[model samples]
Structure formats: C-alpha cells, structure tokens
Target: MSSLVPPAPAPALPALLTTVLPALESLTTALGIPRTVLASDEEIEYAWKDLPRELREIPAPLRGELVARMCVAVSTGLFDSAMNYIWNAAILQLRAKIRNFGVPIVAQILQSDFEERNLVELQDSRLLELSLKLNIVNEDGFFFLDQCRDVRNNFSAAHPTIGTINDREFTTFLNRCVRYALADASSPRGVDIGAFISAVKGARFNSSQNDVWVQRLSETHDAQRQMLIIMVHGIYCDPNTSEPSRLNALDICGALNSGFTASLRSELVHKHSEYAAKGDEPRHTASLQFFERLGLLINLNESEQHAIFYRAIERLWTVHNGMNNFYSEPPFAERLLELSKQSAIPETIQDQFVQVVMCCVIGNGYGVCRAAVSSYEQLIRSFSPREVALMIGLAATPATTLSRRISSHLSCSQRFKQSLTLIDPASVPSSVRATYDYYTR
Candidate 1:
C-alpha cells in the first residue's frame, strides 16, 4: 500500500570495504593471481562511492539478505557476483508482485492453469512478459528489466561471464533493477474470480449487492478490472445465460460504463468482432444486442455499423410495405431513429439509409404512414450533411424508387418537398446546394 522509504546508508560499508580490500589483495598476491582478474582498486573505489546513492534508491523492504550480499560482493570488487545477487533480488521482487496479484487471476488472464509451480518455473524473460501483461510493470519497467535479465544471464555469475563490466556498467545495472522492479510500491490485491463468477450467475443483484461488487471491481488493479469487464461482457452476450444473470451483467457494466477507457472499449470491440469473425451467429447477435443495450454501438467499426443500419432500414421498409403498415412502421421507424442518434450512419450505408427512410416518408400510391410521420420527421431533421446531400440528389435520380414515387403520386411529391423543408440549410453540402434549391424552389 505504501512505498518503502530509503534508509540511511549502512554505517559499516566504508570501514568493511577498507578492511576487505587489503586482505583480498594480499590473498591474490600470495596465490600469484593477476590483480586485473578483479575490478581494479580505482574501479572498486568508484563503484563503492556510487553504491550508497544507488542503495538509497532501493526500497527498504527490497534490501533483503541477497541485496546485503550484493553490497558485500561489490565492496570486494566482485562486480560479477554483485550483479548476480542484485538480479536475484529483482527477480524475487517481480515474483512476489505476481503472487500478490493473485496466481489464479494471472491464470485466467493467461488462459492457462498457472500456479505457484508455474510461477516458480517461469524463465526470467517470460516473467517480464507476464509482468507487463498484468500491468505489474509499465513499458519502461519491462524494457529495463528485460535488459537486466539478459545481463544476469550473460555477464553475472549466474552464468559464465561473457565479458567484464565496468564500475559504471555495474552501477547502471543495479540502478535499473532498483528503479524498475525493487522500488515499485503498489500491492495490487487480487479478486477472487471463483466467488465473483458464482455471485454473478447465482441471482439478480439488488442495489446493495450491486454496490458491493462495483466497489470490489473499482478497488482491483487495472489489469484485473479490465479482464473482469470482458468476462462480464461475455456472460451478458451468452445466449444460454439466465435472464436475471443477463440483467446482472448489464447492471454492472452500465454502472461502470462512464469509467470505460479507450483500452477497455477496444478490448470489448475485439471480442465482439471475434464472435463475428468466427461465424458464431448466436454470440454475434447477442454481442450486437449487448452493445445496443449499453448504447456502445458507436464503438463498433464502420462495417459493423453499416450492417446494423442496413438491417434496421430493411425491417422498416418491410413493415412500411406490409399489412397494418402505418401502425407497424412507427416502432421500426423509431428504432432506426434511435440508432442514428447513437452514431452517424456509416457513409457506405448512407445512400441506402436515406433512400429507404425517404421512401417510407413519401409512401405508396395509397397514402403516407401518418402514424409513423413523427419518427420519419425526427430522422430527417437529424440527417448529417452527407445524408442531406443524398436526400436532395435523390430528386435527380428519377430512376430510383423515391424519385419515381415523387413523380407519380401528387401526395408523395408534396410530402417529399415537405421532407426537404425539414432539412437544415446548414446541413446541405455545397455540392448538393443546387439540387436542394431546385427541389425546394
């Protein structure tokens, strides 16, 4: 919950190094070993002087036994050994973060059965990847920690040394380990996914139950919350889900809707599109309904939007041409109007959308659908500039159904002119201004 504050420098570090360095030199001399085999005296002193500042960067909770050993190794000019110890400390900190983030939740996110054994066996690189995926580490942390992992593998005593690192290189390595992995203060509490799912599926949540779950979701870390949102969406879109469960999902998602970030929205869209791509018709239809229920239809891609508008127009057109057409048309017309209010009609479908709505408004040789006139007027008044252009240009295309009707039926032609009057002059594109003027004139 809180970041560890840096403690004062270890009082014994300078004196301990002063004693250890001479004895190490004497032993090396007695053994007839080259002094160059270890860090030079100047290098050791430079590293030792800089070590305190870097040590202060490590959180107090992170300066464990391994970190103490790393400081001792550094004092003796065993930079490689120091690297190994510090890297161990960093790795341990990352593992602890994963454990605290809840292993089962991690398993859910990975879509695999990850456990303590799996956590323990993860290679350094994979651990970093998981950390990034779970938002345990930000991108910068992942980059630097991955580099540190490579350093531990190649340069540290953990593996055969590829090359010697300078005092500066060692300090840089220590700093990255401390700054990226060791210094992170957040202790993200994991949600109990088992209990969460059971509750969601068990019953319709009352207001109090809803508030509690919402609070729990709000309290979890971003990665876990994001996953839970997606899961809830799946439940909502599942055709076999009980009605109460569906409403439960909706209540939760709707409450949290305002807090949805772009990343969250993108994930939902990806899942929705996945259903369509796999030809999962039931889930796809339910997904579309989900979006519509949440009023998130605007987040769908252009092609999806075009399909939605196209289907809606087709339904309205059918009702307009059927028995009891006037009464039946209003609801379909009103639904289409609601959809247009949700987002701009995709340009790919705009011409068709305009043609159908205008045709419905002008009606057949019998009469206009008076009961649906309000819905039709509302749709017309809300048309975008491109739609306005399409509407005006329909008069020029006499071969089209609306233009044909406008020419043949006096009432249809007059109603078409009244529809033109509903369009705002500002929304008429300049390219269609002449056509608009010709129709109105």
Candidate 2:
C-alpha cells in the first residue's frame, strides 16, 4: 500500500516548509520506521524517473498507500527494512502508473511476493518469539492454529501458478533447481536459510498464526521467556517437523498424561503403514523424506544414533499398529512390502532416490501406470465389463505414456505390470471403471 499520506500543500514554498517540517520530523517517529537502510529520497526519485515514461507520474493517493504497505513490511527487517522500503516503493510506483501492467508487473510483483513470503518465513523460524503463551485460559484456543492455516491459503492464492503444479511436477522442478544450490558448498548460509524457510512454508502449516509465528520470531527474543523462544524456533527450524504446529502443541499437552508420547508415536507409525498398505505414494514419499532428513541429522555411522531416531520409531510404530489390518488390506500391505523392497538398502544418496521417484510419478504416465494395472486386474475380477472398461480407460493410457516417456528419457525400467497385479479386484468400484475405460481406449 502506501508510506505517508502526503501533507496538504500550503500557499508558498517557504510557508509550506515552515509549517510541514515538524510534521515530517514527527512522521518519522510516529511511523517508527527509520532511514537506516533506506536509500536517499533522491535515489527513490531517480528510480521512479528511470521507469517507463508512462510510469513517471504516480498518483499522490496511490503513492501514499504504497508507502504505507512498505512501512509495515520494513519494520520487520534490520538491514532489509530500508532496502525493501525503497525497492517496494519503486515497484509500487511503477505498478500504480499502468493501465494493464499485469504481464510486465507479474514478474516484479511475483518476485516481491516471494521475497516478502521468504522474509515472513525467516521470521517464523524463531516462532517461540511469535507464539502465544498457552496460559490457563477458560477455552482451548484451537482457533489460533486455524488462523495460521488461512494465511497459508492466502499465500497459495497469491501464487496460484505454483498451486497449479502437481506433486510430481513440483518435485522434478525443485530437484533441478536445488541441484546447484546443494552442490555449491561455497554458497552463503543465508541462501540455505532462505531455501529452508521456503521449503517449510511450502510444505506444512497453513494459517495466519503461522504468520504471527514468523513475525514474532523475527521481532522479539525475550530473555524472560526462553521456553517460548526455544519451542517455536525448535519446531520451525527443525527440518523434520512436518505436522501442523497446533497439533504439535496438542501432542505436547498430552505429554502431561505420562504415556501419551509413546501412544502418539505408536499412532504415527500405524498411520504411516496404513498409507503404505493403501498404495499412497505421496504419503510414502513424505515418510521416507522425513526419516531421511532425521537420519542425516543423527549420526551416520551408528544404526541407532540418528538424530531423527524418533521418526523411524514412529514409522515402525505405524507398521506394528496396523498388523491386523495388514492382512485384510492386502493391497495396502503390499505397498509396505514394495516400500521395504525399494528402501531396503539405504545409501548416502538421498536426493537421488527422491529425484528418481519424482521422475517416475510425473507427466503423461509414469507414476500411475503401476497402480492402474493392479486396479484393473482387481476390476476385472469383481466388476462388470463396462466398469472395467471405464477404469481401464482411466488408468491405462497415462500409465503407458508415462512408461514410454521415462523409458525413452531416463532408461528406467517400467513397473506398471507389476503394480497392476498387486491390486485386489474387489476394490475396483464401478464408477471408477468408467474412468478407466475412457482412458484405456
């Protein structure tokens, strides 16, 4: 939005200067944003002048709003406050001067949004500073977490282009881009800090409280409230904390129940196994990534020394919790079997496995192919021809095309046939058959 609402002009230059000087002086203090990192007003003026001729005359009203927005954005930054204030002011000035600057402005706006988002995320890292202390209140404030979830949605809406990306597409794109970042050991730690923040926000915790968490993290480090600082920062900074923070708080609360942590950990493992039993690759990949990150943090030499030992324990807990369901849910159980086979031999190359799996899931056919065939067999045994045809159509082509694409580009063997055999015919519902048939033909 805007910086200062322009002071109404007086009759003459000297008259205006005499009356307005103190207000300008007071404005600086009232806004509380300083010129510490701000460029000279002349530089901001020059930046405005250098823009396209159409953008030269930004309306006074719009300029004021833009400045206000920048002021709010700046207060959070130490070095960045002034720089961003000037930079955002420049961008907003340019934006205000246009009729249809959508395409031209998209790049700048998107970039600004990203920077702001990342900054907020960086702030969130010290969440203990931002998180509200759970005092003994009359009501459970679950709404706080709900608010955070809403903010996450807002961020997603602001960047809908990214939202359009499917899981596999995103993974592929990330792997490619992150390769350079990961390889460049000489790169600054700040880059990784930015990257790590982006990754966390992108994956978990959607809400305005999340925004609060980030804001507070950056603004305060109160000596009197050390636990608040550590708790928020620990969760936000820790690479393994994927679940929602509200849930995390609830879990921590249950720790007062003595055996709750063990019970919760067991429940977590059962949930993971359920995902595996049902052939949910997305959840599977998430589990693998979670453990892998933990494993890396823990000692690599000793089997029991992983920093993320609890995550692995949780994974195991899920397996044991659903032992009975494992038999009844044959396809689901087989998913674990498959995961166990694929992940049997852990290596130092975590990224490689992630990339390979990502490649296997995206575009035209690769990931769904195996699942489709297995579902198809299950369909044939239990459903009518029309239903089978529908499902065949739905699942078949994409799988085949994915198979062909990967086989051509990456030389990886396709597994659609194997995946098909694993599905139980009784699980193939009739409407699903129509979807299968449409694609199969």
Candidate 3:
C-alpha cells in the first residue's frame, strides 16, 4: 500500500438536547408537545446538562420534566417556550414545597390573583415572588426568576412577540430554571468555625468530611467568617501550628470569600493598626504582605479582582516608593518582584504602573529602582512589541528628569532591550528617542 495520510474525519455534529437532558424528550413525547414547529437552522444547539453544575438537588419528577423542557427550549433557541417551561417548573416546585407545609402557604401564593382578577392561578411572577418571601430562593436567584418572567411575558409561546432571542438570552433563561426552580437543596450541613479552626490547629485535612465542610464553608457566611477568623488568628495563635496546615488553610481561604479584597481588607487593616500603634511594625508586616500574596490566589470575580490587583500594586508602590531608605530598600525591592507577577492588570494600567515604577523610584536616583527593573521579569516579558514602541513614544515629550529616569531604567533592563528590538526604532516615542539612543549605545 502506498504511504498516504488519511483525510481528517468529518467534524462531528452537536447532539440535540435529548442526549443531554433525556427527560425533556420523554416529557415532550408524553405531553405531545410539538418542538418541530419552532425548530430551524438558526436554532443554536448547546449541551444543556452540564451548564448548571451549581445545582444542589434535582427537582421532583413532574418539575424535572418541566426543567428538562426548559433546557431543551433554551439550547435550541426556542426562548419563548423556554420561558413557559421554566415558569411551569417554578410553579410546580413552589407548590410542592408549600403542600408539604399546608394551605396557608398556598393561600398566600394565590393572594395576588384573588385580590386582582377574581381568580387564583398561582401565576408565574407571583409564585416566584412568594418563593423569595419563603426563603426558597436567594436575592440573586429571585432576580433571575423575575427577569425570566419578564422575558417570558413578552416572548411567551401563548402570545406573539416583537422581540427575538439569541444565545445569550436563552442562556439567561436556562440559568433561572436551574438555579431556582429545580434546585431543592438550599441549606448547608453543620460545619462551623470551631470545627474548622480546631481541625486546622490540630494539622488535619478535614478532607474526608470535605463534602460537608467544604460545601458548608462555600455556602454560609457565618462558616466563612469563622474560617477567616481562624486564618487571621493563626498569626496570633499558637505557633505550634504546622506549615502544611497553614498552606492548606490558604486553599480553604481562597475558597471562602467572594470579594477577596473586601473580605481580607478589614483584617489586614486591623493588623496594620494594631502593630503600627504598638510600634511592632515588623510583627504586623506579614499581614500587609498577605495582600500581595493572597490577592493572587483568590477566586474573586473578574472586574473586582482586576481592580483589587491595581489597588494592591499602587499600595505597595506607596509603601516602597523606591526610596532606598533604611526601611524601604530591600523589602520594597522584594515587593516590586511581586508586582512583576501582576500581568492580569489591563495594559492601560500596566503602562502607568511601569512608568510609576521607573519614575518614582529610579527618578529619585535610587539604585533600588534600577535593580528592581530587571527583577520585573514577568512584567518585562508581558510587554508586547507595540507596548515597547509606546514606551519609546514617551521620550517624544520634553527631556525632563522623569523622562531620563524612565530612559535609564529602560537602558538598564536587558529584558526591555530585547522587546524594544522587536519593533522598528523609528516607531519608538519621540521623547524616548534620545533615551533609547543613550541606552542602546
């Protein structure tokens, strides 16, 4: 046989939602629902089953069928139907929860219908509103349900709509169902501070009970705060605690809070005050240092995380300021290396931070800035060719001391030199030209 490369296999087709949410197909068949009436080439199919893994407990059978139908409708771009299915699921879940208690809850749910239209239908919006009152849904979960109902009303299968649903809209619709309507388990088990702190103090993983402890830690604020208190208390607690326990505590710490900065900032500031007031700055230095360290590891949301990173760099810069003073030099130099790892900062802020590092420290003629520039290996490596050109463009301004200091730092760093060479020297900043010349020579 001739040696010939086989052709690449045909791209596999995406599975219909039936494969992902089998209950949906079965439900549709049982209800004699006609999904084909709305099916079209524009219907963008995505796997729906794995989309909402935060789901704690699946709904009862009747409600699950509705949830599955919602999943299928959303994945296939039948947003109008998706809304109705989600609404129906919400109603069923609420009724089931209430029926377990009594008619008082049902009476409350139908109060709005009885008051307004001489009828009680357990309406979608009212049922969701009552779900919030009953604490069946959190604030965020309720917001999603309310929004789903609004979209459902305007683009419902029972009525004509002036709007269209894209993938994003359908994704939102699908999420409401998964998060609120089908979710049955809302409370975490009884893992609290005493358990967590005692475990950590004793050098145990608590991993065997992680399902209970981790979920409890992840879900409850009281549990999270207790965990944080222990993490902070470790600084003051018995040093008999092992390093492994401390390291593992950080993994738990990273998991506990939503806003990394917000959660840790108060404790950090308190530590700073306590030490700084007692003339024990060195004892407290670790708390301040934790910001630079832990901020990197936290699982904060994107925008807030980015803001915290920028703020952290600026704060470190303020404390260090490239002064080369008895208190500032070596420690500041070390912290500056920490700055180099903050590559997630947007390029706009990146340039400004670099400029500050160059001008604020080296501008004062401190060897620390010059030495620190090379240590900014991660930061230097992050600079794009275009960014290097922008740095040169800065030289186009009048040759002030700030300009010269930036130039001097540029000249001193071998990393920046390599990045500069990647772009045409003519593209460099006009004010940066002489600095480039002086440095390159």
Task: Pull out the clashing pairs in model 3.
Answer: 392-429, 393-429, 395-430, 395-431, 395-432, 396-430, 396-431, 396-432
Q: What digit string (tens of lDDT, one per residue) describes model 3 on residues 1-441?
A: 799976433323346544534545565678898645443333454324334442223534443576667665666557678768767666666655544433442344344323323213667676667556545566888887788778777877857886766655666666666667665633322233445666655554556643455565555434234534445445432245466665555556555534444545555456545665786655544443444455542332344345545665676567555344435444554555564554355554656655544443343434344445454443544555455545655443446434665456654354334435544665656655676786566
lDDT of 2 by residue, 1-441 (tens): 879976444212122234433444466667897643343333333322332221223334433554444333222221123222333343232222221222222223234433333323433212212122211111122233233223333322222322232223222322221221111112110112332234344544445545544443333222212333223334433445556642433332222223223433344445545656788766545544433432221212233222133333334334323444223333432332233332322333222222222223332222233442332233234333343334244333455433355455432323323333333555556756454333323
TM-score of 2: 0.19
Angstrom error of the Cα, residue 176, model 2: value is 31
Shift of residue 318 alpha carbon in model 2, Å: 14
What is the C-alpha RMSD, rounded to one decimal, of candidate 2?
Answer: 23.5
lDDT of 1 by residue, 179-266 (tens): 8888775657677887888888988899999999888887777878888889999998788899999888888888888898899999
Q: Which 10 consecutive positions of candidate 2 have the poorest summed lDDT?
A: 182-191
Q: What number of backbone clashes does candidate 2 have, counting pairs of residues 3 or more apart or in separate chains?
A: 45
Lowest lDDT block of 10, candidate 1: 9-18
After aligning candidate 3 to the native by TM-score, how far in Å is the CA of 368 from where it should be? 16
Give the per-residue Cα lDDT of candidate 2 at 19.
42
Instruction: Highest TM-score: give the candidate number.
Output: 1
Candidate 3: where is the Cα deviation over 4 Å? 1-58, 61-136, 140-190, 204-216, 219-245, 255-284, 296-336, 343-377, 382-428
Ten consecutive residues with minimal summed lDDT in candidate 3? 111-120
